[model samples]
Target chain A: MDYRARFLVDPLKKLSLADIDPDDTGDIDKEKAAELTATYLQRMEEDQFLLYADGRQSLLVVLQALDAAGKDGVIRHVFSAMNPQGTRVHGFKQPTPLESAHDFLWRAHAHVPAAGEVVIFNRSHYEDVLVVRVHDLVPREVWSQRYEKINAFEHLLAENGTRILKFFLHISPEEQLERFKKRLDDPRRHWKISESDYSERKFWPQYIEAYEEALVKTSTLTAPWYVIPANHKWFRNLAISQIISETLDEMGLELPPTRVNIDEIKAHYHAAVKATENKKSD
Target chain B: MDYRARFLVDPLKKLSLADIDPDDTGDIDKEKAAELTATYLQRMEEDQFLLYADGRQSLLVVLQALDAAGKDGVIRHVFSAMNPQGTRVHGFKQPTPLESAHDFLWRAHAHVPAAGEVVIFNRSHYEDVLVVRVHDLVPREVWSQRYEKINAFEHLLAENGTRILKFFLHISPEEQLERFKKRLDDPRRHWKISESDYSERKFWPQYIEAYEEALVKTSTLTAPWYVIPANHKWFRNLAISQIISETLDEMGLELPPTRVNIDEIKAHYHAAVKATENKKSD
Candidate 1:
């Protein structure tokens, strides 16, 4: 199945978040996803090497989700397959006074991928239209215009050879509550629990509204947004890995041509061998 | 005389660099400019204090010029009046390997002003359109589209509370030759000379055409471009300083209201003084 077409936010057709079931695992079972993910991860690793070697193109993977939607899980399970040298992750939190001083995009623009680089935005510029809007951080007019600004920004990146892939991790409210309960029950996961985890849950409906609008408005040919079924963590990993590996394949990553003459190097190697033989005779 | 009106590139009318004589110093003489500059600098110094205290707006001054057009001179003579803490200057040189990997505007965008800050681009993103176009560094199709990109970038800056003032320091080829000769004749200025200085002079007409097109295409109400005649160094300083000071004045840079009560603080000061008096008596 073409995961890109399956998960891509349809622009012509108005999408309501309620219509897409987070619990839907499609035809793939957890066992099948576990088996398939390994193959996808293997291809992704090899493809990443070619991407780094090519050193002309870039990839920006943006992940947007509600609280406890398993954004980090996707990164750890999926992105960790690739070499860390060329891959970077930026997680957006509350803006600093210095960051707030400039335009909203200032901080994000600083961390964009360079040539032969892969950058992941754990939560990205979409937050300006998502959290910033849901919480009333700015006026409605201010946040409303950001949809175009974001599209323009992404367009700028796209035109400059940065392939953009955005994923909205869709999780049912029940799944989020379970995840929060798990965090409370487990000491290893205790650090992940925050006051915001519970407090922000109240804004779920507003967040859904904000996110749906941002996805539909900003989705374009160059930078596309995919809504991942994140209720099942294994399924989320499988779907995301499939989409990314396919995208990397589409990048046409190939090693650059070498200018060195191989025959001349072989002659030098023979000459060195002869010299060693001459020294032994002497 | 409104220096803003005097030098602003009229967008409705076609602008030819040849028609604007570089030697035209208007009614200002060296002695008069020297006096008027001191007054402008005083107001500017005070205004910058209010701006920094207000901490909401920002200023970005872009200087675009040919070789020996004295971009550094403006920074040294005029901008030196403001406190170094709030003011910064970025001189755009040849792009580094990493910088070249990204878009042309990427490097420039990284250094845009934060709130209540003053940033001066010695030679700015315009080089992408000017030098990049003149020398055919990129295809005409590629360089041609950069005008709209640059305008969009400036608009982004403008709408985000950054006041953009771009000055194209107009200098004649003869004046540039004379300046280059001065660099050779004076040992103190020998470090400023480069092979590109003389070689670049060969493309004077092409440079003018590139500049004319860039100015016309990019000149906007929010971010206006001024063609400052730069044959007379003092006149250039006088005109630029006049324009900057007037703009800053119009920004209505009032200090943010103090949240503390001065009378309560004064009462505590008096009580502390009385305690000190009692201690002396003991």
Candidate 2:
């Protein structure tokens, strides 16, 4: 299956989360999926190196998921093979007093990737529409207006050479409950199980509705959203890895052409080396 | 020699550019210097990886130099081995119309490195004091106050997690003329030779004085200035690589402690793998 076309949210089509099967793995067996995922991971690393060497464009990966939909797991498994020097992961939590004082996008804007870099947002400005609307953190009118603002913000980034990929990790409520149970049962995972994880599960339907609207409204041709069926952790990793690797491959990255004559530079390098060698004898 | 201490500007003492020899190489032969620089570069790479994994502190390297004083060469030689993904180079030229509309530091503040990253400014907020003062681009009173503003700005970055290193690559007027001649002689290098190269030469003394004051006033203990003798390109690279390696070493970076129990995480990993295997069989 062409996962990019299969999972990409069609703006014209109504975005109903119910239509997508959270457990679907495209009929690929676990071994095949893992093998494919490893290949993609290796390709992604090579593509990232070319992207950095080209030094002209940037990649921004935005990951949005429910509390137990495996956002952290996806990041670790997919990006661990890539160089940390070029990749950054920013996790947006609740706003601080200072952060709240500014506009909603101010904090996120400060961390966008520069040329030849990849930045991943564990959660992002979409929170302004998601949590802020679902929990009445802000009034309806204010949150409603933010879709345009968010779109404009992304447009500005796109215009300035940022390629954005947003993923909504779609998982069933039953799967979330099972993951939460696992966290509760494992002593090591106990720290990750919070009171809000339980309390927030009650708002599951409303949260899905909020996300559906956001995915519909903000996913543009330049910055598209991929709805990944994340109930199966291996498949989620496989799908995301494939999308990212393919996207980077399509970017047509090449090492920047040399601006100076390499022969001349080589000559100077040799002369300089000789001069240093002569100085050593002194 | 302790390059960090030897090259660090002493704030209490009067600074005289004429007193520092631009050709000094600490009596090290070129072969030995190159060998040392290569070692430092490797260490810097390792330290940067640890710094990113540690994810607590950041390093901001501010490079300031007169035209033809070898800032580009220093960056190319010293930092080429480091991962370009974790490192960013922001070269501040004349301010854009939008940039000039705001306060001087407004544009620069936007690009300061975040935690676990290294950002190198080819020219920076110091331009407000150096060029703005030397060229009389702003009124005397306006440019004079910027030293304090610049100091406070760096102080704010320091209070956060950023460790700042500012380098003033000091080259003599004779060396500048020599480099300008080399550029004119080589067609490949002609693109870098601007008309301003000659026009700016007239302001040499004024620029030196402007830089001296900025260096003295803004060189706090947290963000100190290093005056490097840059007439010889290889020596400049050696000094810079050594200083940076030592500074990162002093930062004491370590991989962050795991928040979860490794035994439980390992057990879960095995269980998850088994689940996938079982599903594949089914």
Candidate 3:
């Protein structure tokens, strides 16, 4: 099997950042990475509001990662500069009874970005294929067909004026264990770790296999997944920020012409004062 | 007419730091006011997320104010420390065609805060009564009944579990002109001003009348309105922060217990490591 298919059977435990040869090929310095990431994030924030004022297009950011691989941190740090007015971030946890009753896409569909706004899904519709497939939560046949369903769903969104950016944070099993333990020892971080996280770790191989297959089948031009190496947090943030800034810049949105008329305002203020004075005399 | 009814005839405006007779009355120092507000806000941010994690009550903050009365500044500054995870801010603008078709409360209902979360409405359901009444956009008969409708709607939310805090920033008409001109004079501040602001000033008497009536009719014990004196930003922020912190503290929400068994986690980690070794040997 190729690298994509190999990942499916490739138990998540087998893939550690230590296993990858950093010096052999592609990597950047952490400090440089953080600076670049912050700069690009600032630009993305300004551009997001500019696009909103222009009322041209909507944006959807989809983040998928293994447990403890920095999805929450990415959301907090990457888009913190953006105006809350035009941004909505939704973290999709386990499905609720209300959500589970609908089609797999129903909950996600409800969160689609409106025009001139940016919406983020911390984890999204891909869960139908990944988690549902790994845990046998759905029939094998049912989960198998969802790849095409997801592709069609995303294509529909893209055609209807939503630009989608999907990220797959690729981290090795050793790095994940280090993160999992870090969560346990640190009181501030303990809230994030759960029994479910451990339960899922047991089926790491199955999840890896599922993700590999999902990536190839769903990575279309309309919505491509940029797999970021997640051993280094700074590098991961920089890569994602650059991709987001580049994507919005490609969309060519401009700030709206919203200048005020000074003379008219001054005239109105004087009139209000005169009216108030006459009322006082009365 | 009582104060509530009379305020409707003229609505509240800013009472600037210089204008307020500090020497004559019981006024807190400006520095002390700023510190109290900032500290209260920080505490609220901490307590809010803990409550959210524990899945307790929901919080809805409704801010109703005249133009140039510091709504944006309040949002940007007061809630600046809150974690975006448990906080959502919605700035309601002119009604869309779909929104206009529904009853005034319908649009607001869609954005209600969920359990353990806080939602801020920069301007809210009251707009149906205030702006619509001022502009004659809706028939008097239609807009007139909204006060009772709003009170009932908020009451229902309180019964279900939401704590509502409604604030009216009371500013004088004279101060509004100063703030409007300041926006024009500062290049960075230009985006904050709009043409509709001047046009709206023309109907000040009408709006004042609408707000006074609404406040008198709808300020219930369940979701009471705080008439925040708007002349000083520090004082306004301090008052809001104090109110929010007091409300949450009364609820007594604490962080959830981190009770994962250490032996179980160690066992799990070992299993994960063994799986990795086995995969490598394969």
The interface root-mean-square deviation of each model, in the order shown, is 22.3, 9.5, 3.2
Writing each residue's lDDT as its tens digit, candidate 2 over B1-282 gives 788888899888889999999999997989999999999999998898777777789999999999989887776677665655457677798999999999999999999998989888889999999898888899999999998898899999999989999999999877876676676576545444445666687788899999889899988999999999999888999999999999999998986655555556555545655665686699
Model 3 per-residue lDDT tens digits across residues A134-174: 87899998998998899899999999889998887778777
Flag the better candidate by DockQ, 1 or 3: 3
TM-score of each: 0.51, 0.58, 0.81
In Å, candidate 2's interface RMSD is 9.5
Per-prediction CA RMSD (Å): 21.2, 8.5, 6.3
> lDDT winner among the candidates?
2
* Candidate scoring better on TM-score of 1 and 3: 3
What's the residue-level lDDT of B78 in candidate 3?
76
lDDT digits (tens) for residues A1-282 of candidate 1: 777889999877788999999997978888988999999999988887788778889999999999889887787678767654466667798998999999999999998998888888989888899889988999999999998898899899988889999999999877776676565555444433455666687688899988889899988999999999889999999999999999999998887654334445335434544654686699
| Candidate number achieving the greatest TM-score relative to the actual structure | 3
| Full ranking by lDDT | 2, 1, 3
* Candidates, ranked, TM-score: 3, 2, 1
Candidate 1 whole-model C-alpha lDDT, 0 to 1:
0.83
- Candidate 3, residue A145: CA error in Å? 3.6
Clashing pairs for predicted structure model 2, backbone only:
A85-B85, A85-B86, A86-B85
DockQ of each candidate, alpha-carbon based = 0.01, 0.06, 0.32
